[model samples]
Target: MAYPIVITPEKNNEHYQYLVFLPDFGAYCQANSIIEALRVAVKFIRDYALINELPPMKLKLPHSTGEQLVTFVNVNLAAKKGK
Candidate 1:
């Protein structure tokens, strides 16, 4: 089951770290760096699924909000990342 993992950096401190939330496992992690946090989150989710013997659940991608929010880069540069 593919799930959505939302990784949002804290607004007050950008470089401090990232806050990762895995809703499927109801688990969260705060790491000194983004990469480390992501790695832990994935490992936790995998272990949880295996131990619980829960079948994979299909995840529906969320839709973007209609509101136009301000972003750091222009659309062209953002598009290059394939959003």
Candidate 2:
């Protein structure tokens, strides 16, 4: 029941950096690589769960229209940590 997170490039000026946005949890972060972006997303999820008293993996946000088209990013903490 996890929500999809969106990742976007910094801008036309800088394509190497990226921003991660979690629409359901209302969290975001920036990183230089996809792996780093996932790490940031994982942290954001933890913080959000702790502060909001909601389980991170139990919330699924419905997809909605009227939003910018950005590719959704999948976060894998175990893979990133070499687990």
Best by TM-score: 2
Considering only N, C-alpha and C atoms within 3 Å, which residue pairs clash in candidate 1? 1-56
Full-model lDDT, candidate 2: 0.61
Please give me the total number of clashing residue pairs in predicted model 1.
1
Give one digit per residue, the lDDT tens place, for model 1 in 1-83.
35655565656765656676665556676756666666666566555654576435546443323331211111122333456
Q: lDDT per residue, candidate 2, 1-83, as tens digits?
A: 34567776676536458777887667777878777877677777655545576435534544544432343444444554568
TM-score for each predicted model, relative to the true structure: 0.53, 0.57
lDDT of 1: 0.52
Over 4 Å off, model 2: 12-16, 55-83
> Which window of ten consecutive residues has the lowest lDDT sum in model 2?
64-73
